[model samples]
Target chain A: MPNNGMGTLLKTPTGISGLDEITNGGFPKGRPVLICGSAGCGKTLFAAQFLVKGITAYDEPGVFMSFEESPSDLTQNFESLGFDFEKLKAEKKLRIDHVRIERSEIEETGEYDLEGIFIRLNYAIDSIGAKRVVLDTIESIFSGMENMTLLRSEIRRLFTWLKEKGVTAIITGERGESSLTRQGLEEYVSDCVILLDFRVIEQIATRRLRIVKYRGSTHGTNEYPFLIDESGISVLPVTSLKLDYKSSTEIISTGLPALDKSFSTGGVYRASSILITGNAGTSKTILAAHFAMSSCKRKESTLFFSFEESPDQLVRNMATIGIDFEQAIQEKMLLIQASRPSLQGLELHLMVLNKLLEELKPRTVIIDPISSLITIGNTNEVRAMLVRLMDTLKKKQVNALFTSLTYDGQSEYNNSTVDAVSSLADTWIDLKNEERNYERVRSLLIVKSRGMAHSNNRHDFIITGKGIQFTTSNKK
Target chain B: MKENTTDVVIIEDKLELTLYISGMSQKSMEAIRNIKWLCDKHLKDAFELEIIDIYKNPKLALEQHIVFSPSLLKKLPLPKRTLVGTLSDTEKVLKSLGITTEK
Candidate 1:
């Protein structure tokens, strides 16, 4: 396990994709972690994924003591995410114990402790030599039992026994209105507490996860946005990399020869971020498409994220400008991921992009009109997300180009999206449509290019059938 | 099977009960004492009780779907009833078994 120079607290390294990074390694090893959340907030899924990942990735056997769902239901639910619990159980690598307590069937007679649960868990753990254990929503026992004092004491004992047994455990509970957990289970499991929250801001559902507390271990305190998809729960720990990403001096063509001549390096830095801001229909997507095509022409893979247009529409529309994205896509050199900005939250979009970047390993990534993402979140959130996105792209040494649509009469710097991205970009290009002699004349200006003496002249550019053609005249 | 038949014969014409416990915890010990006292005072030798530790015989506990410790299961009665607790409340225990005791 990799410790982030913060004391030598032994960590467990929960093999869930991005969770370990956020936890600074994982849950404190051999200690119980309380995961509390409201209903439908993915608490159970997070716990299940933790155990499943433990078994598959770490080769550590796990025991899942579920008080809410049955064994079959759990298996079926996780099966859709590609976790075959049945097969894991058959191999003796996993144990599923469903402790059902019906209020009607169970009649409490006198002073009793919940030793039965302990026995069952002990038996299951011993049988498989499990190193990971999950008691899904153990707070259900509170509703089932009438004696609060005995239940509370037994719960405390259960945590101590788990620590003595030396297994990493996840005990889930329902979130309380004022307290961390409904039954105040947080008081018992004092080592670590994680809160999962699901909220709808502007009618868009966003799931966020926060590490409320982790004793003796340093962890990221920010609320990380998580997503539950086909692969399971993925908590996107934004930009775990430091700012020491190696910048490349290698120059790459922007596909427009005359426009490329405006930069001192003759082209953009290989891994630097480029921002192109212009009003709508100023061929922002066209410019982005040309960059993608240029990368594909060099045999380097390119990923084009089109938020406004479908892949087919983008392909057909770009074909009119003599840029053939379809050929590049068919050649497997270019991957176009077109999605509606309203389909999911901005964090999910970033997560999807992160996943694609890992799987595709593209050399260049282009997002057409990043301004559209402004609708999905507040200004600050969008800016933070973009900063993390840029950090990730830079760390991977992938050349990133983002196009932003500035509203009419608003300067490129005045646009919030452009304002946020320009500060992080290595090169900024401002495009505008100027009405000249009853004709709509398009012009491009190099706003700023770091580490390069770029031409500041506003040159007229024409979008013809052969893509963008820049005039040599420096006149506006 | 032979032992089970012999045990049933001994429990004949009496309230046959099995108490499932997990090890010798205080609660389990208390349940044992309470159930014995209840049987002695209420049934007066008319009830037979067997205490089984689930930790020692976990398979039996799972086979019977007995998930709670300190649970009293009445086996010989026509309608079976399971009351889970330390068995400290003699009145509640008897009432759960559908037995009437002298006030």
Candidate 2:
């Protein structure tokens, strides 16, 4: 949807990370955008970030008119986010005007309008030559005044004046029970509307942002998950909408020489996904560790996400199988990230993985027992999350290997996670344990290998001090 | 020293008032005209008046808690009162300010 030559509406970049990309550029330029949300949903933070980023990133001066908080309080609150309001004001890049209206201080006698606020705002904007403006929760004027008709007309005039001033503005409003804003400010601001929602699903609180309307520009309509950290708000856009990834033809080993010989190409495709499903103690983590070690041996970066074990525990336990993750980590070739599955929701887990993949740029990623994620979400959510994860990894050309656990007597054939991931993965391997002569014997089988012929027979394997060993000879 | 004597006379009357307004808006101008006319007819030579444009002195607006434009503040004579709107209703303004107008 390219807007070529037909007088595409210009947009002012909101410089918030990932927000500009979703809005296709940003809010409609020189127009007022209404952001409405319930209490403590980050509306004020979003507005502040927009103004601060305008000053720092785009070299645009801004004015912040707060109807609720004082200038000193605002400066003190945003100081934690590293926004030096004092410094910005000293440099003449920012101005803050606080409009204090007490209901008990004034009496309505006759025909009055809200011209004082408009005059103050105009003065602040003109004083700094601001290119951006934010009116945080202007609906307080409705509560402070007794004349509804005059206030409404004055509010309407204020919005029109903002547009005529030719400066990009953000107006934050409190969410109402029925309407988008408590005062229905959304009706006055017609250029764009964004809604922020915070909810607790399964006892984990997650913040989501959605663009309700954009008059003339195309935008992402889905609810994008956003995180508030030390750097401020970041919305994670789903990267799976388009399937335009370039597939690689290079082959990479599966760590075991015998396992590599099973495939016709002597290895898996470079950027393909591999899923390993088995019962408990069937050496799934051991196989994943071996794969990670092989990727590290090639001098390529690898990220290992462990859900059931701590990093120290994984390092110590992998040492029993002769896999030296400690050395690889010491050499700066491997990064082991371990987190509890119940700590956050499935989407946050995916976001963390996405964030790690972006920061580390690992050539190979291994998630030890992704089945633990199923406990945090329903079947469909986990499936969708995995699909998205796989798409992101493939688009980044990062080979991924995931392990899943099956219950006793369920077998890898009938498990739910196996059914979900086996089809999505390009290479599927199953490990099983059987009782023979009062001992549990482990075996491996290549269930399905895409674009290549693979061995169909199951090979007996053992986990010893030197990693996994195949009892049979390498045979195609 | 004529200006000083006039100031002394105004202070002797003990009636001080301030009008907060935006610059030259129609409603503000009307309010100013109406208030001056009422002051001349009712309190003649007994009250002192000051006009402030909030656009030029926004900090003063915050200090006085001026929410609406064309607001009149009766600052003197204790028990302060505020009247918001164009001062078109002379009777109500006089009653709120405890000023007895001669009919």
Candidate 3:
């Protein structure tokens, strides 16, 4: 849907992260957009960020006509997002008009239109030469005014007038039982319609955004998960439908010389995702720590997500295996984020990871025991999130190493995560703990390494104070 | 006519109203004529009315939070009231404006 040539539709870029990428180029330019959502779904914040970003990033003046909150309330609410509304107002780049429609104060009589509103809007727009406008929850007028037919016609005219005035407008509406909006405002704003939804699945709340309709332009139709934080709204356009990521030919270490020697190419490909699956206490975390240490040694930043242990605990535990992460942490080359898998839903975890990736711009990422994350989500959801995470890392050329814990007797083919990740991973290593001669010994085997040659033999290894050491191979 | 003229001055209570309209549109004209007729038949000379066209004074609309054209606001009376559209319903207008037409 790349718009080129003379027939390209003009677009106004909304500076929200990943939003312009999903909307193709933001909402249809100079047309009214309908944002319908249930209560507390971040609709107003989304609109406010758009207005603020339009002024700050694109130099486009904006008008926010609020039907619910007063101007002071809006200004105070948006202050946490780092928006200086008062300064923008003083600079004549922004105008906030609070339209209070109290149901108890008015008596509707004969034929009348909302001409005063139009005139006021015109005055406000002309006063600041605003190019963008927001009518936050304009549907409140329905509860205040008794005339439905007149209100509907006037609202329809408002949209037409906004387009005629060549200003991009966003009109928010509350979700209705039967329609997209309570008053079915989607019918009036046919150019673009975006729906925000907040759902609590298994007691974990997640917010999502979807484009219900975008006329005369193409958009991502999938329901993308969004995040609302102190900074603002960030929509993760996680639709990596095409397998178009560029592959790298450069080789990288396995962090252990014995493991590197086991591979035919000496090491795995750079930016390739590697999976280390093993039973309990089979040294998965130790191997991931080795990868992180090696990445930091090369001056590359690494992001490690430890679902099982705290950061200090992980650092102390890995220290016993001769992998010192303290220096790396001190050097700011390694960031370990430790949290329980059940602390939030799968989407929130992914969003946190995505946000960290954007902020840190790390080159290596390690997820210790991705199996714990599987316990919180269904099989399909975990797989979808894993795919998105892996695809994002691959697109950024970030080296990723994920460790999964398998049951003692479970077959790799029967495990849902193994089945899902084995196909996507560029390299897979299987670790096992076996008892022989009345003693338990550790072994490692190369499952698959795409685009490279590797040993198929199982090699026995031992963990010492120095690191993982190769002992003997039965060559089976 | 004699009773209405006497009723206009007998109360000595001033009724003040302001009509906010858009330009000189037909709705504005109709609202003006309706209110004038209602006042003549009811309050006579006791009421003071001023009409402000919103188009000429758009800032006034924003300042007063006026949403509809031809809106009548009872400014002087305690517990101020607002009525939108042409004042065609005589009884409802009188009651909402706190005027006793029966006397």
User: TM-score (0 to 1) for chain A, all models?
Assistant: 0.95, 0.92, 0.95
TM-score of chain B of 3: 0.85
TM-score of each: 0.93, 0.90, 0.95
Error of 1 at A164 (Å): 1.2
- Candidate 2, position A326, lDDT: 96
- Model with the higher TM-score, candidate 2 or 3: 3
- What is the DockQ ranking, best to worst? 3, 1, 2
Question: In candidate 3, what are the lDDT values of residues A192-212, reduced to their tens digit?
Answer: 999999988777788899999
Model 3 chain A weakest lDDT span, ten residues long: A1-10
Off by over 4 Å in 3: A1-6, A240-242, A473-476, B1-12
lDDT of 3 by residue, B11-98 (tens): 3367899999998888899899999998887777888999999999999999888988889988766667788888777677877777
Report fnat for all candidates as fractions from 0 to 1.
0.70, 0.70, 0.82
Compose the digit string of candidate 1's lDDT tens values, residues A319-406.
Answer: 9989998899999999999999989889889988998999999999999879999998999889989999999999899999999999
In candidate 2, list every pair of residues with a backbone clash: none
Worst 10 residues of 2 chain A by lDDT: A1-10
Off by over 4 Å in 1: A436-439, A473-476, B1-13, B44-46, B65-68
